[model samples]
Target: MQHNLGVIGLGHWFGWLEKGVGEKGSLKLVKAVGTKPFEDKAKLLTGFGITKDRYYISDPDGKIPEEFFEGLDLVHISDPNKFHKAQAIESLEYGKRVIVEKTLAINEREFEEMKSFLKKKGMEDRIYLHLHYLHKQPTLALAREMPGLVAKYGKITSIEANFFEPVNEEDPRRTWLLAPENGGIFMDWVHTSEIIFRMTKCSFGGIKKASDFGVNTDYDSVNPTGVETVVEVSGSSYENGALATMRMAKGTEKALANKTLRIVFKSGFSVFACFPGHEAEFNNAGARGTLKILDAKGKEISSESLSGQNSSEIFISEILDFCDGKRVGLNLDEITEIFKSQWEYQRTAGTRRLITDRESIDAFLRNGASYTYCK
Candidate 1:
């Protein structure tokens, strides 16, 4: 497998990509790209000993950026929305593969353009890294296992989901997510709906009706259906001690959201998913999986799984798949399904505005919302 990689941005996300390479078991960061000044770039790579030779040539002219794709088989696009269009097409044009980060494009149009370009370039084989959820082993496992469970437990009855973020005023990306154009909460957090849609194996969990909760009013089209689920979201982060909640559902106490990840099952079971550190608030430091069930006396039965794998090292598993030229176990089709479901939900959802104050929020939770998307 090729160890070479080109980074299009040096912001927070690229740091995540690099941090994972060593643990990825089969990947090496041979090359990387960033627009930081020479001294700054040197400082950033000082520990890695990455030299000028490995530094990607800036696409000042957008002409393949000499040696940009030199030894690498994949280009990790971490650039802002405006650049994904050109960066993705150009990376494919150079015959290098692409591993685009979340919310791959600014909108449907840009995403479509990249898809069309891939078809034009005949580089579909080179595409990798869809939404993060599709890579979740348990979710995929559950999605696969749900049919049997439903066959035994019966069809899902009702679902209430929350997938919103509380953005910090000092942060750029969080603020960016507040806006509608760049996907904001609706687009970023829409994955919650997608995952439920996928797992239940119903198209939008029968999505019948919905109500708004905060400034997050992206939902407006949901209506009563036998198989649908309705959801709401609210958020803010105008101050520090800031936090966010990625997901919460019915019967769960409303807590100040801080990268919280939990799911409740009708099997009288509950699962909490802990992702690796991306921030002080969001980082669980390592992977920890917990299972909870109500005992006969109403006591809770619980178990947990800790990963020996590092967050970044996980990507190498997929790289090995590419090396073997087989699709293997990656969650490509699952994410595709989630994306489709999300498109439908967004087209037909509603929203509400919640009154927020620092005191009120801290009395429970600071503002925290996750941008995690569905397949």
Candidate 2:
């Protein structure tokens, strides 16, 4: 069955969805909404064989044309973070399945609003968060082997995950990243948070406390106030008392050798690393990466390297499942929990707060004033 897909944004990231949908052959890109001029839209849509009639220009008021939702089986939202909730809620209401870009909502309130809308319509399973990294070969391998490793070594005691990329002031994509409402590192780094949650199997013990530091600076006069260039977050997990730290930076002197995930158990440790060019390798055949395990004495116990595993396959598989009326991974509740924990982390930035009970977290989430941000 071919699912007719409509895209809400035509930015650079939309290319990934276009490529995947084209390759999968189970989905058709039929329509799109963008804020570009007609000539530009003609040029962009020509490549995809999408007619000008199917290409829509969004209004200044951010209203989607009624016609855009006419025949879409699914709508892929790659728009700005601020617009995600309304666009997604509208799509689901129109009876279209949704595939939203990462950081599903900018904050907990928006996430909760979307959750409430879905539950009211009983369409809770119709949306999927596009967390493609979790589908990578290295991550999958780690998830598969983690149980045995934990059984042998002991419980996880500490974790370190780093996702860093040099800021490109010249890139058009940098505009949204600089805005706090569109979400700086707080929204972007949710992928890492999801990875941590899945790695620990929702066993991070409920996030006991969190502290974050954001470095805002001007780069090439892009914006006078500048965007966050560096973000470092540290927190303690609830269950096993595991301490986790994640560092994400937009500006760095040198690119990182790899995006790394390291887990240290009570007795031994293991590390999984994925380099920048893995995606290209993944497309050609599969991405290559390393998984190394070491004993407490620092003696290497086992080391395995993987090659040629495409993570996009996971996205394709999930799309297929959605079309087939099957439930996909990363349900509403799970993603909401992730958003809640990350919000607490963001709210408590630059300070530490030990949340000893659920009541405090509930009270904080309930207070609308705490959710307000600079517009």
Candidate 3:
């Protein structure tokens, strides 16, 4: 069955989705709604033979024409962070299955609104969050090997993850990313956070304590918003009693680019590294990296370079299953827990607070207080 897709954003990432579908032959690009006329420049449309008639530039008022929504089996929402909830809700209300990009919303209030609407309309099964990183080679390898590693090494005691991207102040591509309103490091780090959640089996136990700090010393002139060019987050997870820390940065020399995940168990440790690029890199034939596991005495237990499998390919395959009724969308409870922990961090940005219970987390989210740096 070929599911017709309506894409809400025409950014570079959309190209990966289009290419993945093209390769699988299980989906079709019927129409696209974006703020600009991206058809001419989008290699996916031209390369895949998607006709020009399928692209529709959104109205100046920012409304997508109602007609464009017709006959779409799936709507892929990859617009800016602020628009995610509304776009996903609208797509679901129109009876279209939706795959929304990560950071489902910029904050908890928006997430709750979308969650409530989905429940009210009984449309939970129709939506999925595009956490494609989970399907990446390194992540999949970790999941497949973690149980044995933990058993052999004892309990996981600490984790360190970092994703750094080089930024050019003159590059138009980063305009939205440099604005806090659109979500700076907070929005971009969702991938890293979800990776952590999965790696730990959602055992973070609600973020016992968290602290965040942001600095915009790099491109403050062009980014009047003073959005953080660098962000640092550290916290303790309740369940495993593990200390977790993450560092994300936007402005850096290309030579210094880095994306790495390291976890230390009671008796051993493992490290995974990949380039700092789109999730599609995991799918590229040339995309390869190393996973190194060491025992307590620093003796290498296993070390291997992984490559060949594409994360986008895996993601597209899973998406096809969802379309064919073989698999349900992302688990709502899992998503809720992730967002809850995210909100806790945002609520206490730059400070540390031990979130004692679910009720306390709920109160913080209900208050709808904006994260100071993000606001």
Candidate 4:
């Protein structure tokens, strides 16, 4: 009953190690492919049940060796966004299930190609996106309440969601994240967009007033080497006729750190969710801060404190369910629509200078931006 797994990237080894690795767990890592040397990754791979002989360096041409997929029941592709389409389609050709990281492709064309291939093979359920944020406690709680809230208070009317993480100069992700081929800050919003979709079950309508900082002052330079250190976008949703605004940024200071979602209903009822890292202080344990129901007068109706949980632990459990043909994650059509919205924003969004100085920072704060929990 063991499901053999092969990994296409090593950036997440530390997190993946926590997933049950051997006979005690359902997933067994049979092969590992990465850009790093075998010696550097062998110890970590061994911990994940990958034998030394099974570790292979990816080809310089970026082609996955055909033999690597010979025995894998599924492949976990955590490579950069630009590499997802080729790797995913290739894995599917070998009849292995695929779990890819978010921002599934760098552009709409690539996203659609993956979808078309899946349909042609009739393996639509064989691929899943590793949008781990969806597994966070507050998100799960909000998802549970969405149905009842809509039935009682009517459809959602407005939404404001943002995720800001401090940029670590030494962080390895910064390199590729800034690469033009990977689709810049616009691609990073896939997580935020998917969250909006899941919570409201609405398709993104189109981009309106989208902008990014840190790339360039030239508004036409939507795809550039200097990816957005900060991005903010507002748009509409199809089904519920809601105005949704989302912001995502990696800032150099703690002043820009937060993760929250606010949903307002037609009846003046709202749900405010403080996700992990809502505070400037980050923690290892993924304790989602709180979920509060607020009235139009801003009085708290009910609040739930979600306990600390490991994200990887939740991901592995849900992904296993996905491997069993369960529809626990976003479907291909939803992914296609999300990417379409991203493309529209990229083509139309204006580029602004990076917000680094005190004057700009103060101006940003004064523009009615608040990250604190419902008070």
* Clash-forming residue pairs, model 3: 283-310
The lDDT values for all models are: 0.47, 0.64, 0.63, 0.66
lDDT per residue for candidate 2 within 1-375, as digits (tens), equals 888999988876677766777787778899989988758768778787688888898786456888999988999898877888888888887888988888667877777777888888888789888875777666777777777877877767767666554444543345665465776566656666677766555533345534333322433222212111122222332224566665544443332223566777777555544533433544656345667776666566676767643666567778889877899878876777556656765565545433324454233323211211100
Instruction: List ranges where model 2 is wrong by over 4 Å.
Output: 169-173, 205-239, 275-286, 297-301, 349-375
Clashes of 1: 39
Residue 261's lDDT in candidate 3: 74
Show the colliding residue pairs in model 2.
Answer: 205-238, 205-239, 286-308, 286-309, 287-309
lDDT of 4 by residue, 227-274 (tens): 222222233322344577776655434655567788887788788887
CA error at residue 312 for candidate 2, angstroms: 1.6
Model 4, position 169: C-alpha lDDT score: 42
Clashes of each: 39, 5, 1, 0
Q: Which candidate would rank higher by lDDT, 1 or 4?
A: 4
Q: What is the TM-score of each candidate against the true structure?
A: 0.67, 0.82, 0.81, 0.83
Q: Which stretches of candidate 1 lie over 4 Å from their true place?
A: 24-26, 56-66, 136-152, 160-170, 173-178, 190-202, 205-255, 258-286, 295-299, 305-310, 328-336, 341-375
lDDT string for model 3 (1-375, tens) is: 788888888776687787687777668877888786664557755665656776777665446778879888988988777778877877877888889888667777778888888788887778888875777777777767777776766666776666655555443444665465555556666666677676556544445444333223444433322112122223322224566665555554554446677777776554444532564374457665567776566566676778766777788888888787665545888787555555665655545323334464333322222211111
Give the CA lDDT, 0 to 100, for residue 50 in model 3. Answer: 51
User: Best candidate, lDDT-wise?
Assistant: 4
Model 1 reaches what TM-score against the true structure?
0.67
Runs of candidate 4 with Cα error greater than 4 angstroms are 13-24, 151-154, 169-173, 215-241, 277-286, 307-310, 326-328, 349-358, 365-369
- As a whole number from 0 to 100, the lDDT of residue 194 in candidate 3 is 73
